[model samples]
Target chain A: MTVPGTLYGVGLGPGDPDLITRRAARLIEGARVVAYPALAGGDSFARAIAANMIPATAREIVMEVPMTPARAPAQAAYDAGAARIAEALDAGDDVVVLCEGDPFFYGSFMYLHARLAPLFAVEVVPGVTSVTACAARAGLPLAARNETLTVLPGPLPDAELRARIREADTLVLMKVGRHLSRLRALLDAEGLLDRAVYVERATLPVERRLPLAEAPDPAPYFSMILVTKGADPWL
Target chain B: MTVPGTLYGVGLGPGDPDLITRRAARLIEGARVVAYPALAGGDSFARAIAANMIPATAREIVMEVPMTPARAPAQAAYDAGAARIAEALDAGDDVVVLCEGDPFFYGSFMYLHARLAPLFAVEVVPGVTSVTACAARAGLPLAARNETLTVLPGPLPDAELRARIREADTLVLMKVGRHLSRLRALLDAEGLLDRAVYVERATLPVERRLPLAEAPDPAPYFSMILVTKGADPWL
Candidate 1:
């Protein structure tokens, strides 16, 4: 009887090859099969980050998740991806699924984890998240002492975003691609424009960091705005 | 004229040596001078995380930061440490200050960065945080889509903590040291005890994960409670 193999969801930290953990690097190099998600027709950022470390002889599984607001298409893609990974596991081949940032923090790997965890042995290797990456690049300390840090998506409604931003001691607004203009206006209204720092492609060669006031009109999907309210708590 | 050496704030990730990034490992291995904070009379968590990677030839700087509610003692310790590091930098030897988690996210390195950044070249290498580590160990997806994630310090006043917990879509209560019983009671009051997962010393050999209701009282300072309201968002 062949023992089923374990599925490892490996996090390749925010687009930096050097940021990959030693554990994740070793896993990628030793895996018999590797899996990652790609945009419907675009390249895989996760795979690209770990490209140098992945063994050339290992088989690759690419799940083409559609870039759409509707959840069904992406869910279907993950469903398909999970099935393929299960097949590999059943065949006693350990599969390493690459995830951008930490696997359980807003990562697509969670979708597959939901489906496959019940039947297979799954482990999550956490990675450096974009929140910390942006903070490091922007030279900002997120929260200190008893301060509260709030993370919100830019696509959220204005009222909710405003209330949360006002309540938060430090804020990280993520998925700021199409919503950059509106998010800027909202922050400006809350008197937080000067406090906000916009960062995109953190830890990468082409990374950009500027005050939110000077950010590009249409920021990239990977962009984020970090705002630390009031005085510097650490000081 | 000798060029003053750059100060690198390297994040070692949560406790596991393997979780350290390749960049951080490389920095530690090649470093000539290393600095880290230690409890006034105790061992340094940051140093222990990267002890294996640190070169035998490296000179160590231990800053004995007194663990007190008053900030004056710790600040003075950092001031003294920064002076020593500055002297080394003036001598043209790069200093690597080891940080246990992402340096910019509630890390002690931020204090040093604030003190030395004005006079020296300082760069922060981001690493996996305990928040993500706890999430991964507990198999909990932090936040997805438009959900708001609020991170609160468990030491906050009861009223403030209760209000924030109620308002948050997903909550991560950090610094769950002496407040474990109180936090558990608060969560129970909000009907969130079942939804909360307690994780302590994540990724280390001594890591513990359990439901909040079953967690031990007097949890360590490294402990955290992750609570996700409502049904599984991914499912």
Candidate 2:
């Protein structure tokens, strides 16, 4: 008999169907229910990447997770979302929560997991992080021997931003959407502006890479900057 | 007609057959010639992975790569390996050089790539990194949001190692073979020894993880340590 109240947090990988791990694919395909967070009615990247692995007859639940910044409001939204996921687990169904990239790497799925892991069985399947994805897409090494790799979110204070860039051989600046211009100035002051490569939606259908100095605002949160020594390999 | 004198660096994705990316699988399955790095006499994880992706009829070339501390000898080994790959591409055959993890992530495949990419046509397909694979196997997040993730080689000077341990939220110590004991002492001094997880032969058939205190010298070069909260998730 199948175990009840079980949850599988599957990593859909970096927006490619084939990149899904064999174990993740199996859990997803055999799942009695599958849930993925969505911004709206449109298809989510996580869902699309995991589209192939999901079986035809499984129960598909597109959970609408609200993006709220406030503590109380966000907690309410998370509670409601967790309730929906719990409903499936309570029904004795094996539910697979599909997440883009790794589930724990700044991903929103952690909320649902934190609420449920203590009361139920939970397993997280790791996927490729965007740092590795973009580095590979750019045909460059993330870090060489004796090199330090640091991943800093773009919203950090100017001091933190400058410190991270100056402290490592390689730095991946995530959340570069609205802060591209500020980061560009920071990199310029640090003398790393010339070597930085801005990659947006790396490994996705609309993936693009350009020099960070020329990158204007309007990039997405899925974007990142891979700054390393050496010229762009594609050039 | 296929272009002559073009090379492809394909990511083998850890050591599992199923972890190979779909793009990598298509390229390998379609390639006229497949090449992979081997220590000697042909047995290699990269080749075994690519072999599972392609049909039985595909041609194979095993490039011998000898890792040496001397710069001159290593360069010669890379030069010879690149030359062997050039032969297949010269015949108007699509050649795929399979590499473990992402091609540019600390693997010897990058050496061959550096030699051939300038003079020949080249394409690189990034796959799942071993860090990600090992993280998946352990079911732990490598680093969370706002967490400092530092990947060091474990042979760093004592002061540098101590500083890294003090500042990072999540630290991954790679290339840890016989230096395990010294590392354990350092972590103990930093009060992180109990929390450290040591993994050997990550994602391979005999992969195993031990508490930092119990690790003997059975681990190899490819092994790693996932130190949770190496960097504080939140400041």
Candidate 3:
């Protein structure tokens, strides 16, 4: 029996190729096989982020994770991908699974890691999360001193979103794509619209940063909204 | 008048030298003058994280930032540090201010950026936050799907902390040193203590991960407590 090779969940950081960590770069570049999730038949943003570092001779496993409201298909895709990765590991071949942002922070890589860790040697390399990237790009301090920062998804019930926003000194709202209008309404009702900054594809070449009030009606899935309540002189 | 050199706030990532971003590595390696915050008469963790990348011949400016409860002295130290950095920028020598974790996420770099942005060109390079690094090291997914994650300072009033914790599906308690007992009490009251995990010096050589119940009464200042509620199968 061959010694099971290690499976690496490598975070490429937020879109910019330069933002890739040295450890992740080394893993991705040296791996003989690299896997990444893509929108069925679409290009992989995770792959794009680390394109500069991935060796040209490396084999790629493009897992087509459907972008839909249903969760079943995504789960199935991860299971299949995990099985495939496990096969390579069983064959004594290390596999690098590229992930956007930090692998374990609300990332798809977690699903694969959950499925594979018990069977094989798995390692996780962290990266710059979108929250930090957006905050840096927006020229705002996320939180300081003892201030609390809350992160909420846009799809949450309006009341819950509003309550969470009100409970914290700083807020970062993710998954603000189709729920942008509803999110905007909630923020407006709470008079937080003026203080919110919207960021899209942060750290990428096509990054966009704007006030929440001026943001597009239906924001892209990759967008984020940050709202600050009090005066933060650093911002 | 000389062309003022840019002031770079470089995030060294969560205690691991290999976690440093390529951009931050370049800035640190090329910088003739570098600055890092250190406790009075103590070593600088930020500098230590990026020690491998910083040029040996670099002029170091170790700003003694007091860790006392008093905030006034800390602010005064930042002001002085910013002034010193500004001097180098004015002299056409780029200065790299080393920061641990993302520079804009609850970091002192923001204070320096706030003071120097108007007078000098400043660039912020985001890094893997301790939150992400801790989550990865702990082998747990922070948030997924529509789950809300709230970050609270350990020093918050117990009532406030409980309220915020209740609002979010996931909680990350930062600055959990002296406040561990109070925080543990709040979590216990909410019946969430069993789900909590404690991480200290994440990604570093001296990293520690354990159940919050088993953690030391007084965790280190660099420690974090993560509490997850409900079933997140990905975790």
Which one is best on lDDT?
1
Query: What are the lDDT figures for the candidates, one per model?
Result: 0.91, 0.75, 0.87
In candidate 2, chain A reaches a TM of 0.90
lDDT of 3 by residue, B56-96 (tens): 89999888988777778888888888888888898999999
Candidate 2 to truth, TM? 0.91
Better of 1 and 2 by DockQ: 1
Per-residue lDDT for B6-97 in model 2, tens only?
68787777776776766777788787778877875557778877666665776877766566655666566567767777877877877888
Error of 2 at A99 (Å): 1.0
TM-scores of all models? 0.98, 0.91, 0.97
At residue B60, candidate 1 shows an lDDT of 95
Which is the leading candidate under TM-score? 1
Better of 1 and 3 by lDDT: 1
Write down the C-alpha DockQ for each prediction.
Answer: 0.77, 0.46, 0.71
Interface RMSD of 3: 1.9
- Report the lDDT tens digits of candidate 2 across residue range A7-98: 88877777757666666778887887888888645557788888777788988877665555445555565677678788888878778989
